[model samples]
Target: MQFKSKKVIYQVFTRLFGNTNTTNTPWGTLEENGVGKFSDFSDKALEEIKGLGVTHIWYTGVPHHALVTDYSKYGISADDPDVVKGRAGSPYAVKDYYNVNPDLANDPGKRLEEFQELIARTHRAGLKLLIDIVPNHVARNYEGASTPEGKRPFGADDDVTLVYKRDNDFYYIPDQAFQVPDIPEEFKPLGGDAHPLSDGYFDENPAKWTGNGSRLAKPNFNDWYETVKINYGVRPDGSYDFDTLPQGIDEEDHNVHYQFWQDKDVPGSWEKFRDIAWYWQEMGVDGFRFDMAEMVPVEFWSYLNSHIKAKNPDALLLAEVYNPSLYRDYIKKGKMDYLYDKVELYDSIKHIMQGHGWTDHIPVVQKGLMDIEHHMLHFLENHDEQRIASPDFAGDAEKGKPAMVVSATISTSPTMVYFGQEVGEPGAERAGFGSPTRTSIFDYIGVPQHQRWVNNKKFDGGQLSEKEMALRDFYQRLLNFTVKSEALMGAYEEIHFYNKEHTPGYDHRLLSYVRWSEREKLVVISNFDAERSYDCDLKIPGHIVQNWALEDGTYSVRDALYGEENVLEIKEGVGHIPVKLEPLQSYIYAVGD
Candidate 1:
């Protein structure tokens, strides 16, 4: 079903991976065995997720990685020296569409039954589960009976002459010193085939230097993701060969004889994918997360969205696309119902809370609210990147950073809390992408280990430093407030800008705004800065609010029409009737009661 309002998506990455009991490292062995399996966790874990009042539950990596013979193809070693190293099963690497790794599902044949049971449990407690699906490209170097002797079959290709000059070996360039593998006669490379290091891959940018840049010489799609690129066809051979339509092909008709790796001509590719999706559906999965969504042609989604609507429409679809143009396009095309709003996230947390930008950041937050209401997926962290707790940019992991969890929950979109973020996990980092707190989902860090960490209360009062508690409490209260307030569910607009400009007394620390519905009105004022306060003036609309009550923190309210309207003073570290906000505080007031 389409998400009706904001949701708290409990990221299960850490729960599945970090727990020693439930987790197995390096894809092969489990420390605790059956970590995320329904039988493994105390009902409390999933129950806590439901307690957050989230509408959707997104399980990031539920799919099994296909077992490949070649280690290089999978970007991993099959027989890693350390058994724990096998825990790095990249969830994106889908081996079989239907099979749920035994670790995830106690039983494969009865996987759907267990999943349906879990969904029923969740629904009974009021929630939905969303899974991940990677359709952009299949796992490279994956060998199946369907896979030919040399390379994995991408899709059906008829026109090989355009790519190669020889009979069966035409896909290889002259002096390439590579032999085309024993690809079935019916399935040959479409065009631009090579020794996997062909120049000019996946570039369609109008600006020559702009975009993700050119593909690398190696054809390892998993290595840097830049190793091989899919062609979207905007320019010429160097840019986008799609622009140079062959003589026999109809350029306007993207469906004609083109160099598309997949069946670009077929309108029913989405339908075919639906059948594959149905396999997962049969596995009792309620939804899927689409990977590299922007790369897929618009026509594919046009069919996919409609197909999903007809099938198990209750299934969730989350798209992993970042750019604004691509975001707008996917949402408009009905291709994706939700899009990640990282800009809103980065700006709100960095520029606003870190006190680096404007007090006018509240206006930016207002825009973010508007964006979320229309189409935005809110998230504080995920597996692909570094942990928010990393001591890279902000200082004092224990006491002095910005309030990320508070702002993330309070922000206006459906929220996703990555696996270890709640417990203040500091995960490993990649060279360029930044530090991601998560490790492999199934291996390395399993449930049993997490159980020890949890018992130790490594993130609790004594073990965790003051700053950690602040971050934790911020999230706890934010979640509690989200559940307690109706304003969080209402459509919002900026009633006032907390500050006019970024000046000496601009108060970049405090952000104030309002959200209103047919039944009630709400004023949300937050202090993003650590220890700064300002005499902020909010011009309230006439006759809209006669009386207001603070939903969470204490705060004072005054009016120009009625000077010293309401004197709210902070008492006992909290204001009673008067509105008073503390460090990293958020006040939600109900008006006209």
Candidate 2:
């Protein structure tokens, strides 16, 4: 397979990206706290995001979910507060797979149309669109109000008395009534606000399994009580009820995988999800980001993803899978385009940034996964992770500089940046559902630092401070460079080992590497220490110099990041370069000009 330059993804929470409200009262309603609409992403806003060098925009929370708001006037049912997580609700608890959230549309009846228009706008801005596809679960009170004709809602034709059925969409515990979670005395639905559904009661004769696979009649507070798990041909006794993928089929392409499933006998749930993905593809969505993808059976993914790719070969299929052991299986067999590098790379980088680990482990990790390196998507912040500038995290926005640089240029993988990460958005708001650290994915909240960058929808950094502006500028420069660099897509060789062995003061606090192609070559280095600067002699090995076939002489190298130039001398198949780096600084030097 041919390699491509790094793709940059900008993830924005759909409801909070354009919200200019500053009133962050816990459990506040949409009217009180204000909500961002699809119209909020004006041409100016999208152009600004494009200018930041984003190729794809993952518009999170676009699906209609179970929220505590009343949309009954629009023929949509109201969600009970006792069953909902927060004022805005969890995006993963999808209610209708075919319809978008009405809260995002200026007119509730035109929610789907508004989303379609947003897709057109995104394409016009020279970017692709990605939406969430939560196939592992759905809202507890799942109802598809806007489902197309001839399409039935989930569980509509199911027999609720059985504990498990291959055709049933959900697993039910017979004869048991659903019980609302017991909350602390201080905590109340909607913060003690009075509502008819806030009496700690819900009506369900046969309690279904909770979203996290809890079979309890009454799940605990920590359980995912707001959602219910979907049945996907896996029996409760750990036996497969569906046809398995043929052995040695993991190496085949999606087209072959699609053909393999054409005559297979699968359960109804598999076909239902395939139809759902097809529905979204017809709606002009460029791709999908599957939540908790590991929870679903890999065979089901093979069935669904292969069909999706057959329709649009360029469709991006990303998933949130954490297990390192299953990474290759998911990518090769499940047909996933990319999986989160959370357990290995992200965890290692976080430890290094927090002063708990050393950068020496990074080279070992990169070498270990060289065969599947491009399949691992690198990121510093997402909705689930803590902000880089949060108090519980590094507590300083500048600490992300070296980390982001390394993440973007380390391999041929795609890179992601959460919406407010550029402007140093410290997610410190005390939202209703969870404590402070990560930006609340469940509440009606406003991001302070990102709001400054929004500048009341002007899409300018008019309200940002000098430090914040500088941080965003740095991100823009790094991202734009990564997307256009040819050497980053070619080959990687870790030079840290050679430098540490040859240089007197080279140690674990600094990391260095080289990336090269037939047309271009780059020398990259980063300083992880926040308090110290390093001046060292960086060396390129004789084998690498011979591979490049460079004549021994003096050469000038220019830092692509900061426009600083230095002289490098090549003697007898070896290249020696001098580097001076400040605290948390990085250099990407274009060699042999």
Candidate 3:
């Protein structure tokens, strides 16, 4: 449970990572906008990713999902367009827990074997593997293909007559037939292509509840109508049908949580996911990235995550849980390793990037989450958010430098960077299923900026513009230093407040902090201002001066990331260093004798 090195996670949308197709036609078929296969992650490609100082690679959308492609030759039925999101489908709408997306394999029938090969390749490259697991819902037409021996696929044992049976895998609407959501004017199934199944109908008897918990037979167009919610022993009237965790269990760790559930029986849904996790662990997958983890009960997590850790103590368990109030429960009792820090840090930093918030707000957030900060992972861009260089975001990749530095260095939590974020992809592609601000998760399209680095599967930066190469170099230096810097893994104390009051010319647009261990001391500073640089004297506090056991003398200091050498002068018991911070600049200086 003790974190040693700072871990960086590189998230690559699996379907888009190596696609070289430039035909970005909206609503184009897979033939027009080709998909990246599992085979595409060559040893060279993985080496390029590992060179970013990443410890893990989260292959987004790896599971078998409902899509509009025909795969009858591979024993998979064609999915109805009415319920599929795009030519490629929403990765979250998983249709089979036992298999991977056929679209990612060179041979559809050997899809699982190909993915196993990928897992081995990733580990051989000295990087770990992390894949998505959507526990809250499944594709509307989940197949559960390739079920293991002596096990039933989900809903195979369900009683369709009951609305909420304790052991039923999915909820049912007793007498009503399933109805597809009303199609919005802005979208059409297959982009109005004339397919037989695109007749504006999806057949289902006694429709299950929509993924968003919508009870309507025909959900609204905006609802998560393509997915069906899983029933985890919680009934229609909101009563728990299974055993609950002990009252004080939230205050304990996973070991205790696991012990508590040892003798007790859990809902069937819990068993389903537990088996799935073990299946991947057996395949050597290092961890998982759970989707909408908060929607499912915490007891289930305690049941599953502890089971995972018991098998492999080093397995990483990252999740998407937005409720700050429940953070402790998930981390402590539920045994989760990390959760998304979007609401607090990402939201505040985003405002600063867009010219609204001040750097002063950053410390307040840190102060509040100090107890659980390391358990909260930091990210600048992911599948769910706008790219840092998008017009709707900061509008320039240069503007993200300071924000990225702050997010990465402010905590010991894992740092995540989307595949294209380092090179400033603007997410401007007009992919068929979504808008401009966010990358399309539902369509088959190439990522122009990231594709440049792919360089026709050479996995080289040959096609990058000069500016892009520079940006990527900045990332390389910052990220590479983080994993090796002992101070980053130790203690942290912010000097932003002290400097605001004592240092002349210091203002809310600039912030400073110090990180130290017995062997290393670092001065980290960032300028949040977009248009103005600052010339100021940054002071190291007397307490920190004492912590470092310094005297009235000079110490050689140099920026570890960009090599700005300077001298740190300690007069009496206080330390002062003159610094020049360019607009949106950041510095991480190593203090030495």
Give the per-residue lDDT digits (tens) of candidate 3, residues 87-173.
Answer: 799999998899999999999999999999999899999999899999999999998988888877888899989888989988898
lDDT of 1 at 511: 54
Q: How well is each residue in 1-593 modelled by candidate 2, as lDDT tens digits? A: 35476889999999999889999988889987778899988889999999998999999999899998898889999899888888889999999988999889999898889998999999999999899999989999998876779877888888999999998999999999899988865456888889988889988779999999999989988889999999998999979998888989999999999999999888787888888889989988999999999999999999999999998999999999998999999999999999998998998999889988899999999998899999999999999999999988899989999999999999999999999999999899987888788999888889999999999899899999999999999999999999989899999999999989988778899999999888888999999999999999888888888887777998889888878999778988888888888999999989865
Report residue 53 deviation for candidate 3 (angstroms). Answer: 0.8
RMSD from true fold, candidate 1 = 10.7
Each candidate: RMSD: 10.7, 1.3, 1.3
Question: Native-vs-model 3 lDDT?
Answer: 0.91
Model 1 lDDT per residue over 1-593, tens place: 22234566776652253244432323333432434564442355556556544556776655545321223442332321111112334566554444444345556446546655666676665667777776654433221222224432322331332332111210212222221123332222212123232232322121111013222223222232211122233222333222222343322222222223243343223434656666566655667778778766654554565566555655567787777666655665544667776665554565453447654654665464465444577665676644555554343232222344334434456667665465566654221111234444423344332344344323223445555455555555556556545556665555444223422333546555556555545555566666654444433433233323333333444321112335443333323233344565455555432
Model 2 residue 163 CA deviation (Å) reads 0.5
Cand. 2 Cα-lDDT: 0.91
The clash count of every prediction, one per candidate, is: 41, 0, 0
The models' CA-based lDDT, in order, is 0.45, 0.91, 0.91
User: Can you tell me which runs of candidate 2 are displaced by over 4 Å?
Assistant: 1-3, 185-187
Q: Decide which is better by lDDT, 1 or 2.
A: 2
